[model samples]
Target: MFSASRGFVPLLAAAALTGVLLGACQPQGAEAPPAATAGGPVRILSAKGLNPQAGEASPQGRLLIGRGKDYTPLNEDPKALFDKLEGSMAERRKTGWAIVEALLEPQKLTLDGKTYDVPLWHTWYEGMSANPEVDQKIKLFIAQLAACKADADCHKSRAEIAHEVMAQSGTDKNLVRSLVSANLTQVLKQSEGFDRGNPEDELGQGFTLFSPSFVEHVLAQAQGIETCSNKIPWNQAPPSAGQFSPCVEEFPRSAVMVKTNWDQIDGASPKVSAHATDAAAVTAVLKGGTWPKPTLEPVDPSGIYTVQTTDGKLFGLKSIHISTKDTREWIWITLWWSPKPDEDFGQDRPASLARFNGGVWSHYKMCVTTAFNETDPKPWGSYETAQPALAAAIKASYDGAVEQRNPAPYDKVTTWCSNPNLEHHTGNGRTNCIGCHQYSLTWNELKERPAYFSDTYAASMAAEYPQYGRARRRANFPAEFAWSFGMEFQEQIKTAREDQGFSW
Candidate 1:
């Protein structure tokens, strides 16, 4: 994941991007006659179009224009961009060393004006510490970039940055080169007189800076940091039942299998009940050692299992189940191994549980509100446009679930329950729709299971089970899901927490 694949390539690429940007900024057309004044604020004059201002202010009072165009205030000056870089470096330097300590401090990052001492910062650091050289170089580059006034200045400083980053790139010279090149390109783009060309070009370059490929490299390093940080014993006591702490346990022996039943069971009579029974059956098979290999099987073509179930009884159920009750009912199955009490489960398990529960609520809400009233302009016009409408419906449904007690929209079941057999359990009071959905096995392990339900299951399931698919496809689904579920969750969490007075 390190950006610098080759030692020299990134340096050269950085130089090239700088050149392109600088070329774009240069005055275009014939040389203009000497202006009466030295020209206010080194305005960039170009026929090809100058780079837009880097920050809030314009260069001097006048805008820089094309050689033949009228004299207007420049959107930005090279010096101003350089100053911004310097300012960012200063801020980082002032706070960078203290990042770990600040992050580890209780009640640091705030949400909705409330401080959350969640392990998010620690998790981030875990991911960051892996590639110390990359982190060091990036930090150093930030420092240098902040101080650099021109491309040449950056180039001078980059040698040191390159050396630092290169030392840590391992044997992957190509990766090192690529990273360095990209960084240089970014630095150059930040310079004055660089031309971005068309909108597509500008967008492509801008996005690249924030792209997953870039973020992944940073995150991969962060993950390494997480590993190291986790190894370093904390002085604080373990977290309590509901509060987020580093004491969370990892689940052992977890797997997901997709199951489909060709038999068309009555859609009305508790479809998921049959599926749950089937899932139990599959679990029994896997536990009984029926399958020749210890691989997970599908409860249905669409359902996923971690362990092989005998006779495929659980392997037959297809649709996921949900009851429209105010109370929550979910099955927690541990699928992975971990020695440490708190570090055994996958990272995403809690989130997955929460999402699954929330998703059920969402579907139920959709069914109740929009099921009978099909002619009411169909909330979002039609199923084709149902995505956004579904989202709105889910949010409204969550609100409904929390407010009404009697004449409940849905029946109440168990208050909250997890399989007592599991080694690490979050228990009832603290658990919510979001907490369980955050598990890694729910989405990560399940994603690997095949979809036996539809020929188009790969495509349709691609919408849900992204982890089983190609990298690019997997990358795209989260954003879509976030858009689909995120808005609803935000609204729902607020209402649920307020009504329930729940703490996380």
Candidate 2:
């Protein structure tokens, strides 16, 4: 969910973010040391990074600031800086770092100078149904069909047998059909409505794509979650449909899903709204298209959008959520996207790939949070290509590397994370992507916590957040105000004073 000025509003940002009351929370003590800045303009070095104590020959020791007198430390408080990665995003856009293009693009990674290509998601990922325990469920479901078609039961139609399984497991019939025909091509085809081979079919705009980390979080959590469809209020919906994910008989967790803001006037339905319902007042101000700011164009007749470069666009504003297998953490994600520029930066329509540095658009930008709960103050905010030159200058000063030039001809390559939310945020202070997600959790289960996840994959670049149980986990604090993951993790530690007793 995002709140910014210029008449921007998400359809139901809070719908998925707000809800619940687990218990009181306390921020981590400053005594604890800083962890990975996660993903941002900063770098995560093995030892003292950049200008540890500030570089230079001054008696003041190291020159802490890389840019001018005022700048953020590129190598400290990784959790916080991981919140902003301007240059990296530009780099990521070119490399497919965790965007949907990752699936469509040919990927390569240089490790120690030897390049290794990444595997395709359809081949690399297996849904929970592939797990031994889950496989048993599938097998049992199959046996039901075999019995229905047995010699004596030849009178039973295949549809009859199919219905039996659906009726018995309370699953979606279409899902059953999909399982029976599941495979790489089929999965990819079902995931989106566009044609992969046709340039015209391109999403036409930057859209959100789920990363493998978010997928890992969902499947891992499926291990503990059960069908909420069978629960009290959830049961009122329909079979195979639950209040939470794992509610359906099974979800194709490995199937990477991406979506566009169809509510916009430029989307599939040009007549429909493309923003949050609660903020119609904001949309009224932008009746005339915005210039300088990224402009929006419809990708499909269905209302999906493709906006300008990462400068100022929320390509795919989506999130995914799931409880941890231990029921102690809530793995959720916040996703953003930038419309890849036309090959020639929109100088001409249908720009030739050969004329551009890369065959596709010039760049894309995105950010995400680690699988953290309520306690994480800094969810990973990675990428802003526009400010890369500045970031690189700072990095060069600290790392003592030569000033890097754009290997490609495009200029957006030098951008930095702009923190879209900050544009409309009331203050001038730089806000990270996690700023909004931080409110995505609460106490007492009085309401529901939204599940945030990604939608696409990058061909090469991937902005990765630490996994569950990693030492680099973000901190918790400001008791009484908890995050989804923190609240979930410490749920069992509740005490009378609304303090202490947390199982940790």
Q: Pick by TM-score: which candidate is best?
A: 2
Model 1 C-alpha lDDT versus the unseen true structure? 0.21
- What is the per-residue lDDT of model 1 for residues 172-273, given as tens digits with 9 covering 90 to 100? 211111222122113111112333243222110100111112222322232122222112121234344322223222111111111011112122231221
The per-prediction tally of clashing pairs is 103, 90
lDDT of 2 by residue, 66-119 (tens): 110111112324333333322232322322223333332322322222222222
List runs of model 1 lying over 4 Å from the truth: 1-504
By lDDT, the best candidate is: 2
lDDT of each: 0.21, 0.22
